[model samples]
Target: MKLGIVITHTDPETVFNTLRLALYSLRQGDSIRIFLSGKGVDIDKIEDPQFDVKGQAQEVLDAGGEFLACGTCLQLRKSGGSQICPISTLKDHYEVVRDSDKLITV
Candidate 1:
């Protein structure tokens, strides 16, 4: 299954659970793609005591999962999207939605 996850919240639990699910899906041999937008873009920058955001995110990447950030969101925050793996525009998100078998928003 191809899973597309769009994370827009910055809450620690939300981020952790979202990535946790991504890991689980990956372990089950399912494809996972995570998109960070809004405050969720901070995942690569901030750390939660309970969850290692950047490290886990890297694991997702290492597993061949896609991790993209909203380019516009990054621009608004003055982040060149260097904070994450790749900067994707709304067009890219639309494509993801159209291609994925399942989509979830966090």
Candidate 2:
């Protein structure tokens, strides 16, 4: 199965949930893609954050899950320096979503 996840919340709890679901999907051998937008982009800037979502994201990447951050959202976050997330355009996100078998937004 192919799954697309859209994360827009900045709250740690929401981020954690997204990561958990992604991990679950990975373990199930399902193809997964994550699109981080809005305040959700902040998650990538936090190094060693208390929630460990970053580590989970890395695990997803290691497991071949597609991880993308909305370019417009990253720009709005002013994450041009080391704080930048994996950059992607809304077009890219749309493509992923369109191609996925399922999509979940949080």
Candidate 3:
């Protein structure tokens, strides 16, 4: 299955759980694309002591799940993006939604 996850917030637990799910899905032989929108573009900056968002995100990447960030959102925050949040476009977002076998939002 091809999965697309649209994350629009910086909530640590939520992002952590979402990446956990992505990692599980990837382990199940599913392809996943995570698109970071709005505050989600700050994924690499999450500092929650309990959730370990960055570590989970890295696990997702290592498990073959891809991450993309809204370029405009990153620009609005004066960010140049990061390894887990590379700059992406609306077109990439659209294609993720349009092509995925399943689409999830959080």
What digit string (tens of lDDT, one per residue) describes model 2 on residues 16-39? 778888889899989988888788
Model 1 lDDT per residue over 3-106, tens place = 99999887777777788889889999999888888998877876778878777777777777888889888888988776354788888888778889999998
**How much lDDT does candidate 2 score?**
0.79
lDDT tens digits, residue span 1-106, model 3: 9999999988899989999999999999999999999988998999999999999999999888899999999999999998899999999999999999999999
TM-score, predicted candidate 3 vs. hidden true structure: 0.98
Which residue pairs collide, candidate 1?
A: none
Task: Give the number of the best model, judged by lDDT.
Answer: 3
Task: lDDT winner between 1 and 3, please give it.
Answer: 3
- Which of candidates 1 and 2 reaches a greater TM-score? 1
Task: Please state the error at residue 5 of candidate 2 in Å.
Answer: 0.1
The C-alpha stretches of model 2 lying farther than 4 A from their native spots are 46-50, 81-84
Select the stronger candidate by TM-score from 1 and 3.
3
lDDT by candidate, in order shown? 0.82, 0.79, 0.95
* Candidate 1 local distance difference test against the native: 0.82
